[model samples]
Target: MYYHWIDTEKPAWAVTEIRERSRRAWNSLFAEERREKAEAEEKAEQERELKEYYAEQHRFFEEMGKKNREEARRMEEQERQRKEAREAERQRKKERARQAKATEEAGDGKGKYPRWTQ
Candidate 1:
């Protein structure tokens, strides 16, 4: 069919060229649109993966922090127990020395420091 664009009937070869050009233009436009859509989808997928990676890393750090806290608490408890044991041992030693002093003084025929001296 002759195109209505001009006053004269276009030669057959000219009509074929126009049609091919129009088809190429339409295909290029659609291809560009498809490429844009693909790029946008790829960007969104990358963002999603990055978010998941960050969340996973945060969880790992949080778990590590919790473990560190538990370990510190265990160490603190152990130190407290050791301190208490040391105090108990010191008190026992003091009692033993007091008993030894009493026994020695009693055998010396002196009861203890005299009330008169006080």
Candidate 2:
């Protein structure tokens, strides 16, 4: 027995013509018995690959997050050091000014250089 399937490439043939070929595309690739098995296997393989890929991305993202956190911490420490250095510079300048004022006052004292009484 043979069945007629809509095959534009092959056109319509007699029942005997279809049977003589021995292999009907519909029977081999589209039969209810075999179709589900092939489709299910292909679907399962694709789904497994997709799941593995997502897992890989998650791991990669976790690693990146750790690296980013470490980088942020390092940058924060550097900024703190820079602020401390700036504060030390200001303190040194203030000390230098105070020393200059004291030296001027001391030099103005004595018989040769006496302080003016006001």
Candidate 3:
């Protein structure tokens, strides 16, 4: 029997022909289902790749954060050292001023002369 493509809504003339064609259509549908399944799997794989990429970025930022903390600590130490040095210098200047004033207040006398002069 000749099959007409335009009238696919009607069944084929023979029962055997109808069954065979139905089986073929079912097989095609199954193939389409498998293709869709594969596409979904591929999409899932792509999402996983993106997730991994972000995770790596997160790790990199964490490392940078540690480095930043170290740098801040070093800067604090340097600041502390500078403040201590300045404080010591200030104390030394004050001590020198006090000693000079005391010398000026004390009058020079022949009795205060060195033992060699005596």
What ordering of candidates by TM-score runs from best to worst?
1, 3, 2
Rate residue 67 of model 1 by lDDT.
Answer: 100
* Model 1 residue pairs with clashes: none
Candidates 2 and 3, the one with greater lDDT:
3
Where in model 1 is the C-alpha error above 4 Å? 1-7, 108-118
For candidate 3, the per-residue lDDT at 76 reads 100
Best by lDDT: 1
**Model 2: per-residue Cα lDDT at residue 57:** 100
lDDT of 2 at 117: 33
Per-residue lDDT of 20-45 in model 1, one digit per residue for the tens?
A: 99999999999999999999999999
**TM-score of every candidate:** 0.79, 0.61, 0.63
Cα lDDT of model 3 by residue, 27-90, tens digit: 9999999999999999999999999999999999999999999999999999999999999999
Candidate 2 residue lDDT tens string, 18-108: 8766667556656876778889999999999999999999999999999999999999999999999999999999998888777767665
lDDT of 3 at 25: 100
